[model samples]
Target: MKQLVKFTTGIILLLTASINGFSQDLHFSQFFNSPLTTNPANTGFIPDGNYRLGVNYRDQWSSIPVPYKTMSAFGDAQLFRDQLTYGWVGIGAVILRDVAGAGNLTSTKGYASIAYHQLMGNSSLLSLGFNAGSANKRVDVTKLVFGDQWNGKFFDAQVPTAEPMASSSANYFDLQVGMNYAYFPTDDIYINAGASVQHVNMPRETFYDGDNRVPRRYIGFLNASLKMSDKVILNPGAYYTRQAHTSQTMFGMNAAYNLSGDGNQQAYGGIYYRTNDAAMFMVGYQLSSVKLMFSYDATTSSLSAANSSRGAYEIGIIYTGLYKNRAFSDAIRSTFCPSF
Candidate 1:
């Protein structure tokens, strides 16, 4: 058992170094800035819809033992009108679980945001948003074991070490700011650009053996949609991120076919590819007040040899116009509760 654990740890370390000279961290998607996860500035940016809901999941390095997996769920909505301008608020929660070698780590975070949107010109709008929240992290010491000091005992047994006395958990505060600009030069085309920074205070956490701190992250994205015809459109997008001493840039283009529908609703199918990541295919359908989408990612790296092309899967859903087309469900309730 000791030898097996040691081998597993070594293999994981080697794989991590091979990928980017460090272990992989939790990331929502290669498609980061879709008015969902990237920036608070995107909250309630959708037209006519007062609310939205979304969820995403990721699985990585299946070839290795104890592969990494992540899941996230989020929602946002518009609040009310102030004269010609509008005010909106959003809330999101994320849970991350990482399994590498003999250790397991988990992080749970919740955030709330407020945003204001105002018409800029004849065909443009400007949005500014701010977010504040708290994050909690926990590490179960019993789950981690050193290769040389294991005797097949498990579950609350004395580890013969005094460093980590009990299961450790801590909470910290975080802040974020963002801005977005959107333009619709024509009735059939739209373009948007945005930038966001998270963890402005650089929260410090001591949940692990080393100095485990939540690093400040920056993200930027650009998106454009072009109408090819009455029944087709092309949506191209790019997302860039820098976090924890690592930087990545992803660019992808997707073409969506507008299936026949009525009254501000449609269905679409798209294919996209990203640099240094995977090729993705997506299909989505929108009806009356609900939208659903599914996507599959295919590995395109040398690690493809191990997983044999299977990579990640994601599903998302959104609903709008619940509260008399004025505000979101939670926002409406909160207006009365006044304490949540």
Candidate 2:
């Protein structure tokens, strides 16, 4: 049993390194909550409010000895709604941090984003946006145990692993751009779609000596909000992303039921599937301007055996508000979208 545990630990460490060093990017089961990380065009795409703020936290692989953790905070707001004749501007910023594995590899990123939204007609809207950011990754090499350190029966830390490690940290700049389109046929139905490209610069990102550039990541998503009745709303969404040779696809649906009748209080629940990876379940609540959500991912892949099907859990909180002194008479109001 001891040997089996060691083997599992080693495999998890390798997987962590591969995830951080290769094609896969950090992700969350609650993708919709992390709007800025999903696409830059979502920076200021609030449909029911003038400003928004959100935070997300995730812990993964807790069944293992070492767990991976990620966190993010973001805020965005719409501007010039009273001055612009046909369009408005949006500006926002996001900060993200992650720590992984026994080596305690840490990554931090920050971005500033802007977008422009134009009203095409009474029922349609168009948006375009871009973001620029910087990222830094560092790891503690001493805590890592190499294969060469094994001495038949056990591993020896005193043994020097003949590996040429050039540096302990790396930094790079990143850029992304995206566009969104929304159509509301009536006051009860809304449809939206968007696509974005990340790592537009393909900047170098490696601790070693060679030129290892980050691959361009392409993402696309579609979602709809349907009001079934005055007391219920249904939301269905699909997402797809590709980076280098790897890709991910997800499909999900969420339902909101009004508890206060006036839409000030609501209960939310949803289920999602990530291709062949995992199945996620979510529960949430909204009170006035604040919404809180919790989700859990259950492993469905081959790795489930090592972790007993326990994958990850996440928490998300969001707040939306309007300017107290601003007049809503001339503002473009989206009665079809969810208000929180």
The sequence of per-residue lDDT tens digits that candidate 1 reaches over residues 1-340 is 8657645564655456445623223564435323545887877676544566666666655555556666666677665542233334444433334333335556676677777876664567788887787777666667655444556665334556545533478688978889988877666767889999888887777655566666778989988887777666677888888887777676666555545433356775766675666787777777766767777778786545555566667666666654563433332221210000
Distance (Å) between predicted and true CA of 15, model 1?
5.1
- Kindly report the root-mean-square deviation of model 2 from the true structure over all alpha carbons: 2.2
Off by over 4 Å in 2: 2-21, 328-331, 334-340
Clashing pairs in 1: none
| Candidates in order: C-alpha RMSD to true structure | 7.3, 2.2
lDDT against true structure, model 2: 0.87
Question: How accurate locally is residue 168 in candidate 1, as Cα lDDT from 0 to 100?
Answer: 70
lDDT of 2 by residue, 82-142 (tens): 7777678999999999998878989999999999988887788899999999999999999
